[model samples]
Target: MESPDPSSSAPVLLNIGGKKYATTAETLTQREPGSMLAAMFSGRHTLPRHPTTGAVFVDRDGKHFRHILNWLRDGDIPVLSESEYQQLLREAEYYQLLGLADYITEKLSWKKGDGTLETELTRKDVIKCIQAQKTRFRGVNLSGLDLSKLDLSEVDFSYACIEKTNFSSANLHKAKFKLVEAACSSFEHANLHECELTGANLKEAVLDRANVQSANLQDACLTGCSFIETDLRSAHLQSANLMGADLNGANLEGANLKGAKLTGTNLQGANLQRAYLREVDLRETDLTGAKLGGANLLGTIR
Candidate 1:
């Protein structure tokens, strides 16, 4: 079906770049919210005479200009400029337009490169990633996708199925991974500083030499996940599950791990000074010479 004819003779209309067309002007607008309205914000689009309340958006018919949100939610957006798409993602997020920003951002995320990497994408895609609310991508079924060396920072991928996905050398600073269910995913040399992973399942995931400073892993499941030389200084691991996880030389200084389950989890040379350890389940878990100076162990189950 044809979209509501904005050019139809209606009570409200729009005049973009001197091209007058019928449209529903939106109410309650915030200037400089997204890239689509960059021209309007940069003093480019001339403001039309007020239709009601003397506002630049309101019209006599009282039709609102909320097409961006509608189009994003619908996911059938026509070919849009890169700047416009990036702006839409930002605006959609600020206005709580779910799936709108993510849908658009995914399109701008990957580039078709020649067989050997060096896959270069347009600059607009870069901006879309920057606009995402989180760094690491959350709960997205990225199976059989090649997204290597992409700059994906601060993404929240809780409860996602990311099996056999390649995330090599990506920047995922401060991403939230609470309750995620990713298996056999590769995160080699990724930056994951201050990440949150409560009650997650990362079985057979490779996280070798990833920077995860001061992260939170409360009640999480990381069976068969590798964390070689990962930094977890001063992190919170209260009531977390880490069965059969390899965390060799991971820094856990002064971490809070009270009532945590670490069955068959490796913690070789991990600093645990002043850590809270009440009722912590460490059955067959590797804790060879871990620092326990001034550690709180009250109400702990021996």
Candidate 2:
């Protein structure tokens, strides 16, 4: 009979903020190799153990430690409240678990979805809500809905999933669409003056002839979008992605394009007078017949 390994035979005991936990050393080191727990039990350093119980002492809140243990055991994290999730994220950062910290950060981006509308609403329900003056529609999933030609001005759509939704000829002036996932959506001929669209995903969306004047679209993903003849005067598009987008004959006078990615973008005959193009790489962009009079080309790569 072969002898068992001595390291695998001994179990590890932990004392975390007055709470005791019994686990194996293999469990700590096997899953998270770069974590503090793995380093402590890797037989290289001396651990600070309790004088009486001889268990390793970790000075941290033990409330969310169980979740960490469960995650180490079997890559699973249970549904946690906002507070609990925050606490777990802190613990994960302290323990140097990069993967867990990233996961928690992504979850935090959704803002917990508490008190936010997440259910699907029909067109009639939306119309009724609009009639009732319900402007808040944060975190709602309104994907694949036909809401064209409606006066939906000043509606809040932050963190909402509006993928493939149609809003042609709609009055969406001063509306809020912050951090929304609006891929493949349509806003043709829509009035979006002074709207907030920061960090929005508008990939492959159609915005032909849309009145997007004075709107904010910082850090927005506008890759492969159609903006032909659109009224984008004085729009804020800092750090926005316009890769492969068609901006043929678009009126972009005085628009901000600082730090924006314009790779493969078509700016044919577009009016870019007085526009800010600082730090933008337009080497692969098609700028045929585009007007650049008074446009800031500082730090712009051809």
Candidate 3:
């Protein structure tokens, strides 16, 4: 007959950190071709074995080794806490298990209360929730979703990720969007009266013709955003970043723009009558034909 294959040989006893384990050489080498276990049991290099028991000795903590063996055998892992996952990740990395490390990282991102999606939900799930009247979506991830033309008035979306989402023509009156990441989002023609959007990131967003009157946008990032003809009357924009933003023909009458950055901003033909511009810098802003009658220019630059 043919000589015995080294990889398919008899069970190999291992002494890992004072713990004993019995497994075949093929079990360790067949799964991960480039792993530490494969290199050690490839029969190319000699390994240190206990003289008394003749078992291979490995200098590593065996607390999570069983889990590693189970994963190598059949890719099965149990639910673990954040700390436990972190610890197991270290072990996986040490063993050069790239796939297991990635799995652990994904699981870590799925954990709750971490400013990410606690559970990944599809658009159907969101629509179902809305139909069920469950409007509270705090800390949820709605990124790249199309939620336009929905009557989401008085909904709560605080601390949520809404980047690249389309909220155009949605009825969002008196809604809460505090501390949301809405970069490059669209709210064109949406009804957002009296909405709470303090500390929000609306960078490069489009709000053309949207009814955002009396909405709070304090400390928000509105860089390079398009607000053409948008209704922002009496809205709060204190300390907001409006650099390179297009607010052409927008209504800003009686709005608070205190300490707001308007560098390279387009306010052409926009209404600013009776608006607060205290400590605002309008040096590089385009105000040609803009209405600024009775507006406050106290400590303003330009």
Candidate 4:
């Protein structure tokens, strides 16, 4: 029960077996004279630092007090790498730390070209959102989340089950949703710039009026989805299913629609400039009012 740094302090409360204590953060061991470990609590071990080592309280190999300095600037939990940031992000999201999660997301959005956290971090954004229990979003499982006409910009949902969720009018800029199961979800009027949806299941989802700039929908299942008035500039939809989907008034400029299924899908009033449409199936798909400037429509039949 070592006291936290005076400069960085939080309310100190101790708890034993099913009991609460008025213990300070100073000396949690049994050897300390005024120690509170023996009264209500029975265990005495230090927090672990090294994976190979053990706990730190009672000589069990563990992390040192000096590591606490590493968490000097974290608002609640300090993170060192993207994986760590992602882990803490889940914790923060689960704990309903709205401001803190948003803060970390903003920090994560920094381009990795430099020494920023984003560069140092890998893509572990969307999966973290699946199990979030905080932020007034508790009890809202991905199996049935109705978020119609809501603003959910820059949120994290890494390993969640987003099946049959409705996300109309959400702002999902730079959001991470990789390796998730979002089958049959609706995302109309959403902004998903630079968002990650790799290997996601978006089957029968609706993405009308959404901006998917630089978004990654690779190997995703978007069967029967709608993309009316959507902007997919520089988006990657490689190996995705667009069967029976609608794309009226949508912009697919510089998008990779390669190996996608467009059977009976709509593309009216859409722009496909410089898009990669290799191995796309356009059988019975509507292409009316769609601009195909600089598009690679090679080896495809309407």
Top candidate on lDDT is 2
CA deviation > 4 Å runs, candidate 1: 1-139
- Tens-digit lDDT string for candidate 3 (74-173): 5546667788889999988998887677656655654554544533577777777776564877757788888899888888887677889999999999
- Candidates, ranked, TM-score: 2, 3, 1, 4
* Model 2 per-residue lDDT at 77: 69
lDDT for each candidate structure: 0.59, 0.86, 0.85, 0.60
On TM-score, the candidate that comes out on top is: 2
lDDT tens readout by residue for model 2, 180-234: 8799999999999999998889999999999999999998999999999999999
RMSD versus native structure for model 2: 13.1
- Per-residue lDDT for 188 in model 3? 98
* Lowest-sum lDDT 10-residue window in model 3: 110-119
TM-score of each: 0.53, 0.65, 0.62, 0.52
Candidate 3 has which clashing residue pairs, if any?
A: none
**Candidate 1 lDDT, 1-302, residue by residue in tens:** 11223223333344433434443323112222353433232343555554553223422221212445245223235445566667666656654545456556654443123312232423345446657654444434455455567766677665444556677687767766665545787878887677777665667888888776677777665668888777666777776666777888876667787777777888887776777877776657777876767778787654
Model 1 gets an lDDT of: 0.59
Q: Whose TM-score is higher: candidate 3's or candidate 4's? A: 3
Give me the runs in candidate 2 sitting further than 4 Å from their true place. Answer: 1-119
Query: Deviation in angstroms for 225 in model 3?
Result: 0.4
Clashes per candidate (backbone, < 3 Å): 21, 0, 0, 22
